[model samples]
Target: MTSYYTIDHLPGRTIQLDGQDYLFFSGTSYLGMAQHPAFQALLAEGMARYGTMFGSSRNGNLQLNIYGEAEAQLAAFARAEAALTLSSGMLAGQAVVNWLKAQGFGFIYGPKAHPAIWQDPSTSLPTVSFTDWTDQLPELVAAAATPNVVIALNSLDALCSVDYSFDWVNRLPDGQEVTLLVDDSHGFGVIGPEGSGVGALIPRRANVRLIVTASLAKAMGMPGGVIFADPETLRAIRHTAFFGACSPIPPAYLHAFGRAQALYRTAFERLQTNIARFENRIGLSDRFQHIPAYPVFYTEQDQLYSYLLANRILIYSFAYPTPADKPNTRIVISALHQPEDIEQLGDCLYGKTG
Candidate 1:
């Protein structure tokens, strides 16, 4: 029988697991704002004002104003025309896919596309891999039976730590238009200025329409998923049956979300500092591409994983994309981790101690 260890306190860089404190490096809380006192205070204020749960459908007559406020703030932060929040990133991805299918758009998914984007194969239309799609993009666009075609991919792959630069947008054949649907969950709140994500790195173009979906639960240290798009696209998505049918995220989180923007900005700077320190201490190899803001480090060796775990460091060890093969151990760094903690980890990895 598989046994699970019990967590005794709130999660931070250090966590109490089964009565023992361990340095944790397996969480998605990149900015480490989940346990921030100020953020927690905002959460408490939200709870006091809105209670624990709204427990109502988004399309219902009774809707919280905080939801609109939070979305507006999110849009402003992301520099998008509009933003929408849902219960989870998976649900948000499904809703977008459903809307795209309804509009008769065929999909070309990247090699390392998230499973959430293509979960329901039955609804997917003329879906193809990125390589295949790239090889036949011009033909596909010219002879597309649908109104539009979409290239769906992640902004960054956690396992490989590679940023999908979306350079193909510029290389598209003249007179061909394709929508770019990106899941920026890994990049959001970690990369770009003020944590605006991959969209900040890539400028918008007239020929391409950019749609981004992300989960706030990671770096923002908040719950729910967010979609950033133009006002017209948002209006259309809001009217979708899936969007209206699903229950909205908690009002407390929405309220806290609006109030936590400044905090997120502050945390982002510290996180960047921590990342720089880590990189400086442990020199990265040129063999693998690295994103400074992304804390995950992937290695194929199991000895390193075992050594870290033996020293009470809990890092993520699993397979790439899935748990079938190609084992990868992921070591995550966060702003919550102290400089000494980073130094200690560096020592362990590089055998350097003073």
Candidate 2:
């Protein structure tokens, strides 16, 4: 069994373990907003105005204007007709799944999908690879009794650092009302031309409806989730008990998010620079699997994980979500990494000291 280590503080460029500091190259803080000075200042400003938390139901008699304003800003940012914010990304996904089930849409889950979008814990999904699943989707959709279908999948497999292509949507047969229920949790603030995620890049069809749900906690560094959809679709979801009964994300975070657009842009630029520098240092190597412009790099060598740790560097190396799952090892880069940090990591990677 793999034993776990404990940490007492938020992880940044470095982390302390056993009274020793190690270069921390693991985590989902892709944009490094959590430790960013300017962003933190904005967050402080928001808290000063909105306080720490807002526990009131969104449908309560008293409503905060920040929620609607943030939603509108998010919708505009994502290029969607409308967007809904939730307390967590998991809630956003479950809300969408519940709505899909109520509409009687049969599900076809894609590869390595996160559990957040599942109909339930026991819902059995195809065990085949993503390519095989896509190859068989057309036939399955054509044979189904009902035309309403929901394809639930992650935009990318973050554990393995694989970027899934959306070209498969173009091959789906017409006449079927297909809803692409994508969990863009990993891609939301990291990829796409404007950092809007994979939703805008998916192929659009007359019969296809695109619905994207994401956790803003990752790259966006917000303690919330969001659902992006067409105006009618979003309105229907908004009316659900799930939306009204649940408490919204802290008004303070949304307040900061609404005004931090330029800050996000600056962070993204820094992140891109870090990625380029690291890629140049690592070069082309078969020991790792990676996607261009993405922050995470995956490897199958457990020995490498141990090696990095021995060098006083820490990277992701553990089973995810469950202990039964295969262990994953990934080196995550972020905007918080200074050029010197990258150089030190490169030295360690090349078996150099100092």
Candidate 3:
């Protein structure tokens, strides 16, 4: 069985548990926006103006203007023709999948694609490696009898600490019209130019339609999910019952997200510096598998999990998505960590004490 623990407060550079303090090195907070004082203050100001929550549907007569304003900013930032916001990233994924299902398109999923983008909840994900899957994608799509197909995948696989390329989209046979759906939940505020995510970098073509979905909660520190697509497709999706019936993301979050752009840039730079510093300290070793400029460092060294715990250092080590999956052990670097914290973590990884 996997172990579990609880903490009373939000984790930053460190976490406190059972009267003990440990250097925290887990979670998807790449930009460290959650614990940022300026960001928090912006959120507080937002709450003061918008209140805690808005329970009505977005389609209701009384609408908060912040929703449209923030979404416009998001669309501009992502370079998408249009954008839509939902209560959660899962809901955003489901809404897009549900819409695609109604259009009668066949689905092809990437190996590490999140369950959020799955067409059917009970369907199992492929057990093959990502490279293997990519190699077979063109042949697989060419063989499918369906006229329309949707290829769903993640912008990058965070659990495995691997970044993916969309060059395969160009290799697929032209017989079927393709809609590329990317779940950028992990990459939204950490990857790509200006931390805009992979939406802008994905190659565009005449016949291929692109849709990018992300949870802003990860690095953006907003309690919401966003969808980016062409204007016509976005209009159709907006009309869906899934979009109409669901509660929208808290207006306060949108309020803060719109005003904290500069703060986000600073955090991204800090996170990059921290990742570089940590990598330099650790150097190249078989003990870790990671990508340059990425924040996660994955490892199969299960013993290190316990060893770090004994030394008051914490990282992710557990069965992810389900109990049947491999224990998702990784060290997550974040912008909140300082030079001293990085040094301490490096010492712990080397089996040395303060």
Top candidate on lDDT is 3
The lDDT values for all models are: 0.77, 0.88, 0.89
Model 2 alpha-carbon drift over 4 Å, by segment: 1-3, 352-354
The sequence of per-residue lDDT tens digits that candidate 2 reaches over residues 69-162 is 9999998888788899999999999999999899898888887778889988987778887888889999988887777988899998888888
- The predicted structure with the larger lDDT, 1 or 3, is 3
Per-residue lDDT of model 1, residues 36-140, tens digit only: 988889999999998988888888887778888899998888877789999888778778888987877877666677765773554343355445655665665
Residue 251 accuracy (lDDT) in model 3: 93
State the local distance difference test value for candidate 2.
0.88
**Each model's TM-score?**
0.90, 0.96, 0.96
TM-score of 3: 0.96
lDDT per residue for candidate 3 within 36-66, as digits (tens), equals 9999999999999999999998888888899
Show where candidate 3 strays beyond 4 Å.
351-354
lDDT of 3 at 175: 62
